[model samples]
Target chain A: MNMSRIVRSTANILFPFILVFGFYIIVHGHLTPGGGFQGGAVAATGFVLLLVAFSPDIIRDKFSFNSMKYTEALGLLLFIITAFVAIALGTTFFFNWLANGGIIFGESVAFGANPGILNSAGTIPLMNVAVGIEVIGAMGLIIMYMLSGIEGGNKE
Target chain B: MKSKEILTAIIIAVLAASLLLPSALMVFGSPQNDGMDSYMIDNGQDIAAVNNIVTGVVFDFRGFDTLGEALVLFTAVLGVTLMFRRMKEDEEYEYE
Candidate 1:
């Protein structure tokens, strides 16, 4: 059954706001309460809202299974590459080599609490973004497949 | 029969409490408290440059675990997709 116009309108209104909040959680993960998994789940809630607003087929067109699969792969690859890059720079795996190095995201943090800069946290923020994308893609694929299964079951 | 059921419920309640109470009562991050957590808390900012020590722990200190978790999620998604694969449109619902 198609959702009513009111529901669709509400979903549309809430979608962008939710996305912004989720992204904020992801990008500020190293300094905030929420992190990649939490933010990704929050973002997926918006997608779920859209799915509920429209029929599965309509929403599926916007977020196809193949696209989601590729997104998951890309996100994981980013995570792996970020982890290994430290080793390429002559450090151990998952090492915080960029800290205090005066490069991108290389600012050494002060000893205690203070105003946090966005450009801080070497590699952690990158990992957060990577994990965020991976979780979002993985969760979206799950919802898509479940919807497909329901449609399949309903058709016959 | 009512008395028997009452006794069974009491027994189960006691058993469950015995099984879970020690864990629930114990302070989290205690005993091994001197290790890891204190180190992370004291040095996490300088080392990882992340204010959030939890994030530092998850992404930097214990990254392999995070990767393993990702792998687990990926495997679960793969399993789900495989289970529901190839169910064509207009195909009849097969019954056992």
Candidate 2:
């Protein structure tokens, strides 16, 4: 079911901003209060807004269930692979091998309080991004499934 | 019926009291074990290289737990999809 023009317009206008903010939260999770899960939830809310404003058919056409499934699998795979890379590097699983390694996201942090650095959190940011993608896909798929179920029920 | 209502009320009150008594008696800011908390706070930045201790703990020190949590969400979604698919199949079969 489509919403009023005003609601649809507002949703269209606000969706990009919401998604940007969610990505901000996910990317800066190592330095901020929000993390992958929280950011993904926020991004999913944007999708939800669009879903509510437009009809299920429109949303379904835009975001297929198969695509969301792949997105979630890709995110989970990335997360697992990141964790396993530590083992390949001769360290224990989930070890912060990148931290202080002077490579990507490997800038060593001082012992005491200082300004937060974006490129110093090792695999935390990577994991955050992975989880964020997974959450977005999962949440979107769940909402879409429920909406489809409702639509099917209405058809009967 | 009146006695059952009274019993239910009493049970609820007892449960509420049991739940609240410890919280009321306990301190708010201080934890029973500060060892892990202090260690994380002290060395989390050096180890995980993140300003947020919570994130460090979640993604670094306790990474396995986060993995488990992610798997839980994935499983829940999988279950929902499976249930809906079954329902859709049944509906289509009925029509045929």
For B1-29, candidate 1 gives per-residue lDDT tens digits of: 69999999999999999999889988886
The DockQ figures for the candidates are 0.56, 0.54
Query: What does chain B score (TM) in every candidate?
Result: 0.65, 0.68
Give the per-residue lDDT of model 2 (tens digit) for A34-96: 999999999989998987789887776688888989989888989999999999999999998
- Which ranges in model 1 have alpha carbons more than 4 Å from their true place? A152-156, B1-32, B87-96
Best by TM-score: 2
User: What count of clashes does model 1 give?
Assistant: 0
**CA lDDT, every model vs. true structure:** 0.85, 0.89
Q: Comparing to the true complex, what docking class would candidate 2 get?
A: medium
Recovered native contacts, candidate 2 = 0.79
